[model samples]
Target: MKLATISVGGRPTPAVALGSGRFVDLSREGGLPSTLLGLVRGWDAHRGAVERLVAAGTAEIGPEGVRVLAPIPRPERNIMCVGKNYYDHAHEFHGSGFDSSGGAQAVPEVPVIFTKAPSAVIGPGEPIPAWRDPTGTLDYEVELAVVIGRGGSGISKADAYGHVFGYTILNDATARALQRKHQQWFLGKSIDGFCPMGPAIVTADEIPDVAAMRVSTRVNGELRQDARVADLIFDIPTLIETISALVTLEPGDIIATGTPAGVGLGFDPPKYLKPGDVVTLEITGLGTLENPVGGRPA
Candidate 1:
């Protein structure tokens, strides 16, 4: 089922789409477990509860005019992102001074992970603030984000899918110049309002072929990135197993599967984002996320 979080009467609530622009209210079913983090921690139970609510008509179908929030607002921790997980992406950045060879080598023995602070997250249709730094070179990376269903440590690749509650679209926004200056990715990636996620979270059951989905990004209505998840060098199962071996994967924990080629940084002069640009990211089976760009507040 397609699930979402939306603002009703100025309050955020859980909802499920019922097609034809109708949605079922999940609030009436004991409300949406406080926040998205809570729901993730108790995803199995929550999913069951939501299903029951819909079946019994305890939840009412509402109009489509309501405002929607990120499927999970205020996730429990910073988002975990994989970098250079696609062969082409790795090749593109291999010898660019960021990494040796500009990224044209085989996949790494282990997943290359990074974190984007929770503060960077914004809901669908939200505005992303452009950093005030004159050297800021904002860029976008469209990815398929996996949401952990249950908390676990030492998860095995064979059983990793069991820990996944669902999936959503993620835009791994970055400050390219700052990234190079700091000599690390976190500072450039952790800026507030940089991560745009949501549109909705599709339950794992609804998506049978997570690896085959088509993903793409557009800036100001122009296509910038496009690729299939099947091209991922490490894939989701391996990532979950590898990451869980290092740290406990908790509910609400997001793992961005990495972006495909065609980022601005790949361009000779680079095509960084500027104030007033609109970005739209879409993954087949998942939904579309759109956000506008503006200067950071003083």
Candidate 2:
């Protein structure tokens, strides 16, 4: 099931997609959780009811007045992010001269983990605040973001898939100069409106093979980054095991598996984002997330 958070009557409502741009407001149906996070928390108990509602298909509304929001509008904690998890992106980043998390090695021995503040998240169709980068080096990284369902620590690679709830697209937008200056990722990656995610969350059950999925990004109309999830240097299970070993994973917790090569910095003459540019990121099975660059100076 594709679940989403939408606006109806000026209030956020949990909804299920009926496809072709229609949604069933789960909130209007009494006895179910009121938010997407709540539903995810109690999925085992609520799955049948949600399934029944979708089957019933009553009061299904069109996309006319409803506005789709990020499946998790505001995350409870900082978002877990892996840097340079793709071999190509790792090498490109190393050669770009902006990588400060050193080691002459292009590929890390283990996952390079970091966090993006919860405040940075914005939903589909919102503008990316490129103006916040004083150095004018706003760049984009389209990544496959995992939404954790079951909470746990000491999770093994073998048990990782069992804890996954669903999947979504996340744009790990960054400021190149900030990244270079701090010699760390948090400050550069935590800028408000830098994290753009979701059109909807497609439950893990819908995806038979996560590795077969293709994730790509387009700036305006040009395809910039295109790669298979199978290409991840550090796959999902490894990342899950690595992070959960230290920090507990909980329902609604998000981990953005790092992006692939072709980020602006990877180019000879970097193509940093400016006001009016549109970035569209798409992951197979998970819907596309598109946002415009905004906050232009006069």
Model 1 clash count equals: 11
Global lDDT for candidate 1?
A: 0.83
lDDT of 2 by residue, 23-97 (tens): 999986788988899999999999999888888888589988898998999999899999989999999999999
lDDT of each residue in 1-298, candidate 1, tens digit only: 8888888888887788676657787777665585656666776667778778788876666665588788877776889999888888877766455552124454565678889998888898788888644576888899999999877999998899999988999999988777788777898888888889988888899999887899999999999899999999998999999899889987778999999888888888888889889999999988788999887665
Task: Highest lDDT: give the candidate number.
Answer: 2
Measure candidate 1: CA RMSD.
2.4
lDDT of 1 at 58: 61
Q: Which stretches of model 2 miss by more than 4 angstroms?
A: none
TM-score between model 1 and native:
0.91
The models' CA-based lDDT, in order, is 0.83, 0.93
State residue 72's C-alpha deviation in candidate 2, in Å.
0.3
